[model samples]
Target: MKKLYHNYIDTFRGLSLEVWWLSLITLINRAGTMVIPFLSIYLSDSLNFTLPDVGWIMTFFGLGSVLGTWMGGKLTDKIGYYKVMLVSLLGTGILFVLLQFAKTFEAFCAGIFLVMLVADAFRPAMFVALSAYSKPENKTRSVTLIRLAINLGFSAGPAIGGVIITGIGYQGLFWVDGITCVLAAFLLLKVLHPKKAKILDVVKVENPVSAYKDKAFWIFFIAMFIFGFTFLQYFSTMPLYYKEVRLLTVLEVGLLMGFNGFFIFLFEMPLINWLENMKNSKTKLIAFGLFLVAISFIVLNFTSWVGILIIGMLLMTIGEMIAFPFSNAFAVERAKKGNQGEYMALYAIAFSLSHIFSHNVGMQMVDKYGYEFTWNFITILALLGVFTLFILLKVLKKEKNT
Candidate 1:
């Protein structure tokens, strides 16, 4: 046990102080992100909107994400990540607070759209910041460390959010989320001041390749889109599953969701550290992760047993631990060919695109066909992502050999 503890501690030994600060900022911001997880529920139960109405609102949320990420990428390349991140954090905080005033369907849709537009811009900027803050050799681990903080915050958010919802109603979530975002922005200002942090523009390509022209990256984008589309169901449909199918209470659902974050917190960094040292093929690992996600969905069909939910969540969490950090590293590496902000923007856009369609599609599918059908559909999509990523792997290898 001592040996295990030391090894886990060793994984974090060499990261820069800036990277730790970045992770701290992410933790603070994400801990307040209890709004998205329960948004659909709030729309459906609290406001008495139909599922399709909820779907449309969520779709608008995705559209905002797409536009926000695109704008963020452009601004990051032109100005710098620091300013963009600072502005984004403040904007999103204010927007979340204002959003609570919108109660009608049209009003809520517009509110969410505006909120996400500002909120998602932070993504590409944050990626740029990560690149600026990290050493090349430590980049992947830095990504993992950031993800660890995100999951740690996520683990706490849902439980606290559930308590808030149960005690004070959903309106309370907005205040907490908004306050946290603003607080994170203040913290960012205090720690990551341009002069004090000495942030560098590290990689300078002699001839920068355009991210738009990279065929391999386009393929990667597609696979990432599918992965995001499918994985997002965890946030979108899975909670509904817990509520309707399992008949679990809101607190129980929150605890169950928090389990995924907690599990990743406990295991992901050590796993990432080991995988990096083993020199394993990143593409293969990602494909395996997709396969596990497919299995996670399909397993629900095999048994109605409530325990299957735990098993499925475990599989999904493991898959996420494998897939996300390596995928993030790959995007960063690819971005070296051109503008880091541009390439990372394209990467962020893929997931944002998923945000646009996945919730609406999943909700509509559930409404039309049922949960069983929806799970099957998502399972098939995940398998397709696995196949697409393998193709990307082969193409990358061919390019290297040529």
Candidate 2:
């Protein structure tokens, strides 16, 4: 146990101070990530929206993310990630407060679209910053630590959000969420060193278009889209399933979501760091994650018991632990020196694209077919993704991304 303790702490070694601050910012911002988790519920109960209506709203929000990440990525490479992150964080905070005032359905739709557009721009910028900040060999640990901070924040956000939800309702969630976003921005603006050198100081080719032409990147894009599409269902359909199908209350539902963060926090970093030390292949680990995620949804068809929910959450968390950080690291590894932001942007954009189309598809399927059938559909999609990714990796290895 003592040796295990030292090994776990060892993962924290060699990360730069800038990456540490970036992780802190991720924690602070994500800790206030109350809005997205409960957005579908807010639309359904508070605004009296049908499931399909909520789906459309979310799809639009995803579209906004697509714009945010693309533009943010371009700007990050042109100017620098620091400026992009500062503007994004500050602007998004203000938008969260504005969201509370948008009461009518049209107002809500317009507000959500704008807010996510501004909010999600931070993603590509942050990814660029993370890659720029970390030492070469420490990329996996740096990225994993950032995710660990995110889940740590997630653990606190929903529980606190639950209390605020009970006491002051969803509007309270918006206010709290807004305040935290601004706080994160303020920390960045005031404390973060402006003149800090980027990982690659000289800017290289700005054209990410060549990346699109690469057969390898397209394969990566498809695999990422599938991973993102399936992973995102936890926010979309799963919450609704727990409430409407399982008949759980708001706090109970919050606890269920919190379980995902809790388990990821407890297990992800230590486990992944250990795996990295064991010289695990990134693609193989990713395939394993995809299989577990597929089984997590399919497991629900077998039983509606709350235990099954916990079991599913645990499985998906483990999958997330293995898959997500490695995915980011893999992209960074493949990126030619000067165009990391563009690569990261494409990855973020593909993920947001999943939010736009595939998630809405899931929502429609859930509304039409109900939980068991919808989950089974997602399972089939995930399993197909696993097979496709296996073949995809064989091609990528030949392309020498190995």
Candidate 3:
């Protein structure tokens, strides 16, 4: 028992101070992530937008993310992750302030687009920074450390957001979020200097276009996209369902949203470390996570009991705990030399593009066909994920043997 405890402790050992600081930056940034989770509710209730209109507005946000991620990745190789990360953080912080003014539909869509465009860069750039700052053997844990920070912050954000909505309103939510972003950027600027330290001294830039040519990565990307569509329902679909069907209040929805992050914070790093220690069957682990995600949705369809929402959220959190960090770690392993940023960016596109499709499909179905059909469709997507990922594993195996 003592040996096992020591082994678990070792999982967190030896990551550089830079990695810890990066995670701290992420925690501060995510702690103020008050807008996105409540976006669907805000649109429907505040703006009085129709379900379809709400879907498209969020879809516009996704489109901006797609572009932002692509640009961040492409530039990180040329400019370095440090600059990209700083600019993204500072730029997005200002945009959050500007977003509060975008009350008109066209203005709101444009605001969301610009916000994601500037903000999403932080992700791929951060992935590259994680690779640069941490030892190769401890890569997974380094990423998990950042994930832990983000989840911890996410757990706090909605709960605080719920309180703020009552006292300060939505404007306060956006302003507070902006302040956190600028604060994180300032911390990064004041503290980090990896170039002088040579953490990134051995890097070499690969052909930026090379990621698209990798058959195995393309296969993984497709499976990731499908998995992401269902995995991201909490942001796009579930909030609306809880509001319209479950009749939950904003505070109740905030608690439910916070539940996912709290559960992830409680379970993910330890669980991921344990899973890695057991074996390296990453694809199997990911597929299993996808299966669990599908089952969470199925639970919703089968029961109207509010208790089921908690169960569903817990199950989905477990699945994410299993899958998300490993997914990022595996993508880092697959990068060619110094193109880590680009590869990580492509990996991010899986979640980004899902925003475009998942919201539109989910909301339209809910409006036209009802909520059950939306859940059923998500189940089909999840099953497809299992099948697609297995094929990706085979491709990966073949690539390795050659």
Screening candidate 2 with a backbone cut-off below 3 angstroms (N, C-alpha, C), the clashing residue pairs are: none
In candidate 3, which residue pairs get closer than 3 Å at backbone N, Cα or C atoms, i.e. clash? none
Task: Estimate, for each residue in 1-402, the C-alpha lDDT of model 1 and write its tens digit.
Answer: 999999989999888899999999999998898998788789999999997798779778888889989988888888888999999999999999898899999999899989988888898989989988988888889999999888878777877899999999999999999999999999999999897895544887788888899999999999999999999999878999889998999889878888887888889989998889999888888888888988999998998799999999999999999999988999998898888888899999998998778877898899999999999999999999999999998899999999
Q: Which 10 successive residues of model 2 have the least lDDT summed?
A: 196-205
Full-model lDDT, candidate 2: 0.82
Task: Pick the lDDT winner.
Answer: 1
**What TM-score, to 2 decimals, does candidate 3 have?**
0.88
Question: Which residues of candidate 2, in runs, are more than 4 Å off?
Answer: 41-53, 165-170, 196-209, 240-254, 302-309
Candidate 1 residue runs with Cα over 4 Å from true position: 41-51, 163-172, 242-253, 304-306
Better of 1 and 3 by TM-score: 1
Candidate 3 lDDT, tens digit per residue, 87-133? 99999999998898888788989999999999998889999888888
Among these predictions, the greatest TM-score belongs to: 1
TM-score-based ranking: 1, 3, 2
